[model samples]
Target: MKLKKIFLITVAVLSVFYTIGCWDMVDIDKRFFVGNIGVDRAEDGEQMLVTFTFPIVRKIAGGQGGGQGGGGGSTIVVISTVTDSIHAAARQAAMRLSRRLFFEHTRVILIGEELARDGIEEVVNFLERNTEINRRGRVIVVRGKAKDALTIKNEIEVLLALYIANIFENRDICARFIETDVDEFMKQVHSMNGNVLLPRLTPGKTDVKIGGAAVIKKYKLVGWLEENETLGANFVLGEISGADIMIDIPGYKYPVVFTVTHNKAAMELLEAGDYPKFRVKLEVKGEIVETPEQIQLAPEMLKIIEKMLEDRINHMVLASIRKLQEEYQVDLLGFGEYLSKYKPDVWEEYKKDWENIFPDAEINVETKVKIRGIGASK
Candidate 1:
């Protein structure tokens, strides 16, 4: 009987402890789920304009006579505040909001071009230090003001964040833009010393276009990489999953459309002399999706088509490299990283002055394409 009495007392004590833990817990209904974050440079140039977009819980739940296409307003709400820092902005916004702003569901982070041009160090710091930020969330550089992008009324997806995040799923089909999540962005910034590429978002009337890429060097936005240039860069990076190439044949009235099935890239350091000589070899395999007219699928004709595809790919890859070397004078390619891993000895020699040496380096590109199929037509 005495042992049973002691056990009961211990159980009661543990129950009391568990109950105390819930004392500070806020109810789910009292919190707001932040869907996206936007950062822009304030007009004064001394502070940051931070915007937060979140779904209205009542409207989403259809509690306040609101439906999917209700006439009241958008299902989501957007609030902004100008403060010295992102954290401060959040706190300042809380003064006007009734519920706490929660970021565990944030799906996108948009940085305005104006602020990106000035620098993104502050944004990076906030992403790293904030424990609530989602690491899998995508980071994009908006073409204009982030505020404008965030305010867009997207009707496709229930939430604007979901709409934007889902666009990245099309990367495999279209390689026109660069995709980088918060975690990958952080890793590249550290590994590449603040040289990275992020997707560009262009706001439209009630919609947004995600294409091309924003070039970031030393944590500052330098310029943009066009759709074709981004596609070429993806080839060198071995990131091409699917791309269509149009080759105009002499006889055919229309161009032949080829779809890439597989691609592989190899880099070689032929000579590490005054101007390092490097060669990039690309092996590509694809199929002809469209043909102007039905022609004999002869072995010789296939060979000719293969050569045309090879030339087109070579031109694209080389043009992208040349622009980066001559126009940007920055190496977004993994040449430096490759040397560090494959030829550490050579990297040690050029690591100190690689920025200046890379521009003058001689790079040769070679591409070989094979036609795997001629589509349904004979």
Candidate 2:
């Protein structure tokens, strides 16, 4: 009888397990996966113009619908809607899309220049609150219309989002563009006193260029950093992985290119008085990539080359700091953070007015370069 009871219990458990069904499961074929999202200012000046790019999975999987439409079978489709909030914009887009919209696959988020300048607090809040959106989604500010970037004809990647997303893969090679994600930006906005640097993307004919950066001060876009300026900021932040430096050789009329192999920067608080002073020292190691004519790879010659590279780096670093001090007056270089961490007493006095005091602070840059190798002896 006990054996019979055990057999009956086993059968009942098996029946319960087999009877369960996917009550809340949604089919993959019934959803539109968003690859990219663009946010801009609406024509009404009050609402937001949101753009969504959805990739056609059928064409991507080499099934059908390859170049069948008027535009010759595009890989992705872009749709725009005007709404007061991101959620509202998503709902508005759903009215036209044949399938349910999904954001779990989103790779990039582009913000229009005007909208970024006005402020990105609302957009930041939306991304932070949305659980469906991936935290790794890239965040960038487009120089012009964000929608323009979304509509670009990308021949490299099937989706423009992937094209933009792949640019950061080579960040270690140049360090001109920063990779800012949704979570990273939100953390900076909340912890950095609303100061952050977001990568800048400019759309071109049939392509898009991701370089430089947009400077955000107090949660508003104040200005932009060119590629060189961006590199300078990276130097101060000690984020430089590799970069190329071109300097005019002393006697030669042509410029010699030095490819940085290693780079580091150190900050020293010289004084913590009413007018704090700081000194930044940058150490760089590079290899000669290109040189004009027959150049001697002697120690003395390397010294001259090293000095020239040092001066050039000093100028670039100063130019970046000048823009921050005079043009934007924003400390996006972590000068305030440094003071707060090392010299807390000094920071306490200037914490209330760091923005104003930062402009008056004395900061200096010093660079040292070592030429390790000259490619191939003649």
Candidate 3:
């Protein structure tokens, strides 16, 4: 009984030792959170930037009208710089900042519209190679100053960094948090004829919103894609499902909107002697989210809606494709990857003359649209 009691006491002591302490715990007070990072194109073809929205012990709002008072005052800071590169900018900008710079907690990275227009690969490549930057961080192309996206605030979110992350994480029309990490982006870049799309952002006087996407071809910012075009691109790339489309019909008081609940698409290459033919097969099913007036879902009306949806999807996809073909001369659709993987023999033949073959390849697209319901009309 004595020996058992002694053993029990020792076990209890050891458990107490293990439970009460953290060996190398990092305190929240000791660290700083990065809200948003900005990048601009320099006159010398380098990157210049200003990182905005730094974290404070307590939340803060700046201005003569706004002072550090009450439970909240000024919790965020804005420190900026014009540097040769992003990492260098971070170090140089840190000199002006009160706290030490760290990227481990950075949630949003914004590239200025100008820098993106010239090319984003230079900056993005640096981001990818850096060991501190994680693949999960959300990236955006800015319409104006990248810093403004971070600094504009009057108590909208507790922390602008988190708010930016939440917008990209989940929620609304013109909202797509579709996962596009650094790895996948680089994969598309490395592919010989692959293209990539980056979600874009814009800051208004009141709020910020998703501003479509930037299309990248061969690691270069070829152009910008509108909302409808991005929807079509998502369909082509199979990046999303359950999206909505609004179409304005003549004589109709309001635009007819369709909420696409299901979509699947694939492309196949057919041999055509010295050349090859391409077939794009797409299947889409959607619910009638909103329709102004009593536009009944009659057979004819449904057929017309189907045709409309098909035309919309097709037009957007074709426009993007043509942009890639004529103006950009780069494929973001991974058509080459598809060929390389499935049709090895064709890839072997086409690889030799892909540039010559792509423009001349006969391409066809077929779409099937199904309208599941007409809301209350059902």
Candidate 4:
């Protein structure tokens, strides 16, 4: 009886420690879930302006049954702070915020064009070092200001971060923008020596537009690749899953629309001379979505359409290549990477002066398009 009593007392004492719950755990209502982060160069030109957007959980929960605008006033709150570093900015914003700012739920990081042009070394460093940030969150360059993009009155989605991140899902149907996450951005920037393409976000009155691409060379924003040019670059990068090409026929009021379903590209080294000669061959398969009225879908007609698509694709790819080579004098198409991986022997000789040689290098493009269907119309 004495031993049994002693054992029961010991068991009761140990259970108290486990039943107290977590000592550092904060209640859900007290924590603010950050949705997006925007970084821009301050007006003073010496500091950074960081903006954070987070949703009000109470408002979101209360407005559940109601429509999009039902959530009290605004479901999210935006806060901005000017500081020398991102971390410092966050700490400074804490002075004004009621709840602690949390970043684990962050969905997107937007960098302003001005800051991007100056250089993204600080931004990159913060992203890499911050353990609370989501690795899969998108990293984008805003056309004008990062704060403007974040402050848009987006009604399509409850949270702006989700609205922006979800846009990448359309990449399968439209290959106009570059989709890169923080993890992939870091890897590419490190591997390519700070030469990478990031998606561009343009703000509007009601909503925002995500298209085109921001060209970054040496971690600095050099220029932008337009929608079509971005599509061409996607082809060379073998990142094209779908695209629409319009072809004009001899006699037609409307042009024929080709929708790409499959795409593959190969790079071949023709010569390793003073300026190396290269050829890019692309094999594409798609279907005709729209055709001119009364147009025949005969076998000969299909061949003609295929030839037109091939020529169109070739032109687009070559135009993008030329722009990068001649105008930008930068290789963002992984040409150097391809050479280093497959043709290491040649890469050794050209890698030293590859920057100067690449602009003058001769590059040819060949495209073959196959039409799988001509839609339901005869």
Score residue 91 of candidate 4 by CA lDDT: 92
Q: Which ten residues in a row have the lowest lDDT in candidate 4?
A: 63-72
Instruction: Write one digit per residue (lDDT tens) for candidate 2, span 59-127.
Output: 776634444433547879899999988889989998998898899999999999999989999888889
Instruction: Point to the candidate with the largest lDDT.
Output: 4
Decreasing lDDT order of the candidates = 4, 1, 2, 3
* Each model's lDDT: 0.89, 0.87, 0.71, 0.91
**Model 2 / residue 72 / CA error / Å:** 4.3
Model 1, 20-102: lDDT tens digits are 87776778899989989999999998789999999987776673444554765788899999987888888999999999999
Candidate 4 global CA lDDT score:
0.91
Worst 10 residues of 3 by lDDT: 170-179
Per-residue lDDT tens digits for candidate 4, residues 29-92, read 8888898999999999978999999998777777785655483688889999999999998899
Which model is ahead, 1 or 3, in terms of TM-score?
1
* Tens-place lDDT digits, model 3, residues 127-166: 7789877667777777776866766764677677777777
Clashes of each: 0, 2, 7, 0
TM-score of 3: 0.81
Error of 1 at 43 (Å): 1.0
